[model samples]
Target: MKVTRTRLTEDEKKAWRQFCQASHASESEMLKMMIRKVSGSVSHTSARNAEPKSEKVTVRLAPGDFKKMDGRAQEEGYLSRTSWTTAVVLAALYREPVLTNEEVNALRQSCRELGAIGRNLNQVARALNIEFREGDRIKREAIEDLAERIEEHRALVFELLNKNMNRWRQ
Candidate 1:
């Protein structure tokens, strides 16, 4: 029998112990199962040997964007942006419908923008409510304009969703 020693954070160690307990498997057995799951037909040793060299890549992100990524990485158990980014890239590569980081960022930005628009519409609705209490005839025109804008936004959202439906299905 061969032994492998690797260091893990206390949280990881606790999680591993819990997993082993739940599965009623020894730690070594669980490790072997994990290796098998990732390796498939390839020998773990051979796969490690065949792995490509890691290359340094530089990326520039806005401060706010970097902070968002850092927070997300921590939540997802990644210690650094590089690791998180690499995992995302690798996962996307294996997925049926791969989207570039730029595309994903654009989608996120669109969602934020849409949310802002929705909030503005809600504020307008509140104002319309107040205007209604005052018996203002101008409230009718404002309501129609607001409804038209909402419909336009809804249609745009549906179009975007429809275009990406096939990609999401996979």
Candidate 2:
């Protein structure tokens, strides 16, 4: 192993210690992640997918503890305890939420609705283009209504994102 050292001001050292504690990550792990990020060797998505699982870890919990964990997992919308544990671990490592199943479904539905609205807008634009070519008047109210619906959907998407992000906040 190669060793590298850097000096930090007292304030910087304090901040680093606090960050490591809050993230539930070892200093070595945090330093490795920072190095990868700074060197442009890893991106958020790539880092998450970089490792494939080929190992298993088994844990033995007391019956009461296991029941509590199972209940918490279900409450968080995880289909299984394993999935919930994975999400919690990844969230700590990456400092981001591993979205719940319900969150994923909600986002999927929103995207589908947005796609339909986009298709409708395209059809309206095509009709307007033809009208313009033939000197026919276009309906202003129809365009305005479509724009309003788009805005509403955009807001809903943002709201969902914010809610999901907050769900994992410590």
Candidate 3:
């Protein structure tokens, strides 16, 4: 069997030993289990009934630590610690931003508003087309008003996206 080595900080070493002792698993066994778990290859059932693509990892935390982590997660605008942890892990893995709950909601709302503005613009264009087809005079004021509204919404969305990007850059 091939052997692998890793350098761990003092605290991490202590934590690893404690974890192994508490779980009654040898250090090598624990390490292999962690590798399998992270790789999503751990199976608890027979091959016929096992789900090969998905696995669950049960993390045992002390009550105090759980409460603290939950509070910290909520303070960061996450509904739960699990979601916050998942976002953090994924962001780290992908080198992407971990958006807070508020940021996500704001983005969703902005997209919806943008869609509404687009629909309104399409309607106005259709109306203008029909008026032109009928040889009726088009209202300049209506076109100008729609133009201004679209510009305002476009600016707002750009501002929102820029703000989010800046936050991630920092």
> 88-118 in candidate 3: lDDT tens per residue?
5666577755566466556667778778867
State which candidate has the highest lDDT: 2
Error of 2 at 46 (Å): 27
Report, for every candidate in turn, its global Cα lDDT versus the true structure. 0.60, 0.70, 0.65
What is the overall TM-score of model 2 with all chains considered together? Answer: 0.52
Better of 1 and 3 by TM-score: 3
Give per-residue CA lDDT, model 2, range 46-114, as digits (tens). 232446945676889999989988998888776457767777777768876567646666767788888
lDDT of 2 at 3: 69
- Top candidate by TM-score: 2
Candidate 1 wrongly placed segments (more than 4 Å): 1-99, 132-138, 166-170
Ranking by lDDT: 2, 3, 1
Candidate 2 minimal-lDDT segment of 10 residues: 42-51
lDDT at 121 for candidate 3? 69
lDDT of 2: 0.70
Collision pairs in model 3: none
Considering only N, C-alpha and C atoms within 3 Å, which residue pairs clash in candidate 2? none
Give the better candidate number (2 or 3) by TM-score: 2
